[model samples]
Target: MPHVQPAAPAPAPPVAAVVVLAAGQGTRMRSSRPKVLHALGGRSMLGHVLAAAAPLGAGATVVVVGSGRDQVEQHLAQIAPTAVPVLQEEQLGSGHAAAVALAAVPDIEGAVLIVNGDSPLLTTRTLDALVAAHDAAGSVFTVLTAEVDDPTGLGRIVRDERGAPQAIIEERDATAEQRAIREVNAGVYVAAAGTLRRVLAGLATDNAQGEQYLTDALAPLVAAGAPTAAVVAEDPDDVLGCNDRRELAARRRTLNDRVLDELMRSGVTVVDPATTWVDVTVSVGPDAVLRPGTQLEGVTSIGAAAEVGPDTTLVDTEVGEGASVVRSHCLGAVIGPESTVGPFSYLRPGTRLAGDAKVGAFVEAKNVEVGEGSKVPHLSYVGDATIGRGANIGAATVFVNYDGVTKHRTTIGDHVRVGSDTMLVAPVTVGDGAYTAAGSVITSDVPPGAMAVARAPQRNVAGWVRRRRSGTPAAEAAAAAESRTAAPREDRSEPSRADSDS
Candidate 1:
């Protein structure tokens, strides 16, 4: 038998964990919820943070939540169902939070990506680049660093004269010369698990706050002669942690712009991305024109060549190619290709439109299936109704599909011409090629090619108005008016000074 070489020790399984620091109260955020729980671009900030790490093949991803642990864990339950949840009740320093979160990481020989949970702008590609640069350089620890102009409150990146790793000095502890250096510490880092575990165990509280600091351990790693380096990130906001309300809003804008920028780069036309808000999982097709004030959210799919409006909101809706939705609100629906929705329309939940369907202005449709070439022109409400192909519905048409307590359904057949102001009562069906006259109230079913007219016949009286001016049409008006006044108890034959005035 050939030498099996002990099965090569099962390949070691590439273990990696992400320790997202989220235990801070984020006092500047000025909210009861933790800063990590703040929403940005739709989901919570920590939700985007976890997604940036979990997709990197992290064997174990840990999020350290504090301040609002219950709510944070509740949110984390949905975002990362399989990842381990760790609680830091003490609300210590960032390093201490990382240490507490690390307790759940299995003993392994891989990298631990440390990031702030409030950093919604962190990209998976940038994170992967940092990891690759670390592995390629054979370094045990790598920190993301950036050179900014101010570097006011940021931690300064301290390096020796030989350009080797020295330490990360906080603004308070930094010397005046070191403080002048523009390179600042970006809170994101990737380091070996063993080194991180050791450094975290050796951390001490000597600072003003008497809290165990993670920044204190960097000096030892550099002192131990381990290959420690700092990879400069292009954008400083990638490591930005939200501290206050204004910063949180700014971060939200940055993150939303980042997502929209990627969408535009991928060929989606955004008229004003600054005003539009899109979720992370929403897929917008190529050539999809997103106008100003457009909100595409909740796994919504916008097909190619579709035009969404200046004031449109689509949630969980799927729009087909060539569909045009102008100033409309469509939720939980599916619109077909070549369809035109209103300049002001409401497409409620469970609505489906086939190809070439036109849902006109001021129209509302719910739980309805409109077939190809169907037109619900204006001022209509088609609730719980199904209409076949080539159905031309005139203005002010309504499907009265409800009767106070029970909901009913109206079915209209193909090539049917329904006139204006027609009310089609529910639980009734119009056969194929049926016609409904204008201002008709339909209650019974109409046969194929038949016309249903349910309005009262017109009664015309000649010289009725002239007779009224002469007191005959006035007699007609008296019969219609609610206040007859008993004709003032006066004789109609007496014309007097009132007749001279007339």
Candidate 2:
């Protein structure tokens, strides 16, 4: 009989309930929208916090909202439906906000993990590490701390004579000696739920700001002989919070750097990481080259060996393998393998370019599908149309897809040649191998192998100018003056005239 090994010990169950404090009216943001609702790296700031919290497998997650409760709650409902929202009627201190969120959580035997919603850079790994440390030490309270070069405006960690962390001192309430301390509170804590409720209930509004300071609970926990511990994060930036516009921009740059670094390390070549902004939700495949000034936003994906611009923005778009997109704006579009698009093109929603196709400079396409091996060169708008394989669309062709009342589509079959300055009105089709003469307005279908020309026959009157001057010397002189005024310009660079011109 084969010997069987015992199964490994089962993993411990989740022991914490999350409370995200987001109640303060972010006055520094100077917007009617709540600060936590501001977008960072494609999603809202609170969204990032919730994303980090998801991996914890916590018992419950509650968000405390104040001034813009309606807007924040509505947005949260879409992104994080499971996170319960509770209103904090007044703008109090961070401790007070956490208390409001905690009240929404069920009274259970576990730890309470309090986090700030504005700190988007906080990672789930760090929170997991904090929980692990708390469990190993068997402490009633664990405070996340970091040592920064500048601890201004942040709460400083107060230590006892033995150099063990004893309490946290807010910047405004700290003395000159206390201000010199480099270790600072990250405003994150995991405390025993029963003890936390008692601490919060006893908090008093007695500080200089006359607000209940969450850090105040640390001293009481230590005095009551309950074991307390502090875990310092390796990276100080990870705990930084966004309080104003300058800080918000700094946070965005930090997040962008993290995203670009991951992309480059994972086989994507980012030419200039400083100028390439990839949102959290964007994905790029291996060997893809992203040039400077490129922004890949919401749900955008680039395939292997693809090159995306020195100034391109793609949102909710997909670019296939070996394709090249240069200086273009594409939103909700798809480009097939080996396709070439734009030095200045705009591809709107529902636009699709098949394999080996080309959409050149100054072209705008919306709700259009260009078949494999087809080409739409320059200075054109092709909307609500389908162009078949091997079609050659000239420089100034337009698909008149809309009437005053409704929009319609035009279809051109394989091997069709659409001449320069051609207009294919809606509800029209050109059959395979059909051609449209230059400057024609095609209003009806053309059969296979046929050419459609919708213009009047040209009529030339020989010596018409001379006839107007045939009478006398005075008449010739007047006609000569008029002829000079009507003479063609010497500049050949002007745009070509339409066939309808006299």
The prediction achieving the highest TM-score against the true structure is 2
**Stretches of model 2 off by over 4 angstroms after superposition:** 1-15, 161-163, 461-502
Q: Pick the candidate with the highest lDDT.
A: 2
User: In candidate 2, what residue range of length 10 has the lowest lDDT sum?
Assistant: 493-502
Tens digits of lDDT, candidate 2, 1-502? 9999999986644556788988888899988888988888988889998998889988788888887989989998899898889999987787788777777775655887889989989988888888888888888889999999989888999988876679899888899999999999997898888888889888899777888888898998888888889999878888888888888899999999999999989999999988899999999999999999999999999999999998999999999999999999999999999999999999999999999999999999999999999999999999999999999998899999999899999998999999999999989999999999999999999898899999778999756656775787866876788889899877756555753363
**CA deviation > 4 Å runs, candidate 1:** 1-15, 456-502
- Provide the global lDDT of candidate 2 against the true structure: 0.90
Instruction: List per-prediction Cα lDDT, in the order shown.
Output: 0.86, 0.90
TM agreement with the true structure for every prediction: 0.86, 0.89
- Candidate 1 per-residue lDDT over residues 230-273, each given as its tens digit: 88887777777778888887987887888899889999999998
Pairs of residues at least 3 apart in sequence or in different chains that clash in candidate 1:
28-244, 467-473, 468-473, 468-474
